[model samples]
Target: MNEHAVDILTELRDLVREFVRERDWEKFHTPKNLAVSLSVEAAELLEPFQWLATGENGELSAAKLDHVRHEAADVFIYLIGLADRLDIDLSSAVREKIAMNRAKYPAEKVRGDARKYTDYD
Candidate 1:
């Protein structure tokens, strides 16, 4: 991540920490609990698009879009919380995963294709 992006993420993470601390919710924010919350929030994030043929690419009503936005934020917050609980660096992990995926799905070989790396000859 760039310096600005890192700063934003740090700010958000700190905000979540303070919110949890203020609520005395840290005890409940265990790695396991946070992981479950994250997964649930991810599923909620998919709710707004559940029946949309075009998914996010199609226009949504303002209310539905707002719902999607809030669900996405919930997922992000839980993800950051889980990272904190696990002492993981989200940016580094994402970057490393991107690098690994680049190798696994090289553009030259995977471009215009929608198959897993294992599916390619």
Candidate 2:
């Protein structure tokens, strides 16, 4: 079954949760280990772009983009798995953080500016 765009994230998250459960790997997925894995995967995603010159972040070749895509998926999988084990609701957590960021970076003061939020003061 196809998931709608708004539902796909949750659907993929549930799929990862079920895949881990069926394999009985819960004991192997402590938050610390998952966090480590997530960081490692994120680093791997950066590998293909590491040697690119300036202004090259958007210039990845098709093959490199595919590699980046897979590594990013790995990061997302581990992140959701970690969140599931911690009993965190991913959507609400992200929403709350976004709200905090919005408060810290009001558009009137921050628009077109890339400085840190404190710079808005």
RMSD of each: 1.0, 3.2
- Model 1 lDDT tens row, 15-38: 999999999999999999999999
TM-score for candidate 1 = 0.96
Q: List runs of model 2 lying over 4 Å from the truth.
A: 1-6, 54-58
Each model's lDDT comes to 0.92, 0.86
Instruction: Provide the lDDT at 54 for model 1.
Output: 82
lDDT of model 2, residue 39: 98
